[model samples]
Target: MSFDKFKPKYKIHSETENYFKLRAEAGAKPYDQLTVEEAREGNIANAKRFAGTTEFEGTVKEFTVPSKQCSDGIPITVYRSKQCDLCVAPSVFVYFHGGGNVVGCRQTVDTICRIFSRDAPCVVVNVEYRLAPEHKWPANHEDAICVVRWVKMNKGLLGAVNRSTVGVGGDGEGSRMAALVCHEVPDLGYQVTCIFHASAA
Candidate 1:
């Protein structure tokens, strides 16, 4: 049976209803029916499409930088608001995209990073970590730690508002990584001022 028949009875906001309509039209396959690679590609495509519709008042810069914790260099996209040009150092928010540890990349959260950068008036670093089932548990977590550490160590280079005002955050599986980073890296000199998690509803 088609899942649309099970739509919620309660009235949802128009925007939400439109979002569901878009998803339904996208014809996403059941996760169980797809291979890891297929799921990843599909999620990326969806994210890119969603991102294309968003308009944020910020500048984005892409980089492929080395990570001490992971052999494969990390890919990061930095988002900064125009106001940031006036400030000597903008605060930083390191973001991880949601994918249940199996699907997603930096592009998956491109729009989110832009929103955060504009609204928070801080630099948003969207991290692209290796996925799971292929690169198992703790791998993503380790990558989170590495990215946070790398940001902390290189805050000046990142144009951070202040080296001391760093934060970690994510959605879904990415949230788990953010929480882990906050919990595991307490000893780091710079404090993670915020830990934002957009858990699934």
Candidate 2:
């Protein structure tokens, strides 16, 4: 049977519905809500908050940008592809995964990245930054910066990603990173053409 046909609908708890109603009355719009700017901030916050809540547990592949020396470490667990194309498509999207600056992994965001790669017909880089509590504030941020820099430095390794047309997005804590990266576009010598922050805590 088709999965959609066999899909089951579980009833939501009354309390849950009530809570949602309360929020709706309080000027909360879950779908198609808020202006572009407002949504951007809210989503970024959610990505940052839910950093340690979700994950991807399964077989995974690894990609490395090996350093020339022992000090130049470079190997990232890739959850998506970065094949270069020869066409003049659009820009690339460098994504950051959310894990509250604590948990979560690149595998957690793999599926989404694949979809994005196909849909946007552009390059997508899912940054694997260091977690927090063990690293702290600038730790993850620094990792993010480095990853973006690496992508730019090695765009050829990335799938035909147009360096001029780049975007950054994230979930919860990742969303926070996305926003920060977006703002630092000029400073990073990268013009983050677009920014999307979703359900960011």
Candidate 3:
């Protein structure tokens, strides 16, 4: 006697297949949808959060990192305190401004940087990276890294930061940029002692 085997066949539902295809097509990351203005607003909110209870009641020295172009180049505003013991600080904080990568400047975050400078008494390098829509993605990241690397290379010329200890930090989009710089630019040859990301987006 021979036994017959039955095979089960299933129908392909067009609706289900279409639904899955649509989902796969929409699998992009959420950030891909954010507008420049929305990103900027988010960064500002993050900056406010980082500008915490720290206060400054001391003298500060203003210094700039030299640059070729001012439009979308990396510029730095340093706030230094006479009371700082740079030799022992073990880290200089290079701060990137928070403007959602769009509309903030060194002037906007001056007070906050000064406060950090006074409180920590370490060199505070406030970076002015390029904004979005005009200067997006790697532009901002490159600017931030360039400034930090330059400072690290010519610490004596800069005269404000401690060469021994250099830290890169920022808030929101700035924070994201700072992290990228820290991770990639090894030639800066500075260790990231601490990253102060005040509400990073």
Maximum-lDDT candidate: 1
Runs in model 2 deviating more than 4 A are 1-62, 65-87, 161-164, 187-201
Ranking by TM-score: 1, 3, 2
Clashing pairs in 1: 89-160, 89-161, 90-160, 90-161, 91-161
Task: Give a tens-digit lDDT track for model 3, residues 108-134.
Answer: 577777776776666778877777778
Sequence-dependent TM-score of model 2: 0.55
- Which rank order by lDDT, best down to worst? 1, 3, 2
Per-residue lDDT of candidate 1, residues 30-116 (tens digit): 677788788878887777766674567656787766766567688888887776776666778888888788777887777767777
RMSD values for the candidates in order, in angstroms, are 4.2, 12.4, 13.7
Estimate candidate 2's RMSD in Å. 12.4
RMSD score of candidate 1 (Å): 4.2
Clashes per candidate (backbone, < 3 Å): 5, 20, 2
Clashes of 1: 5
Tens-digit per-residue lDDT, 76-171, candidate 2: 543333322334644567777765665556656666766566555456676767665555678677666666666666655554443445567777
* TM-score of each prediction: 0.80, 0.55, 0.59
What residue runs in model 1 are displaced by over 4 Å at the alpha carbon? 1-11, 54-59, 86-89, 161-164, 187-201
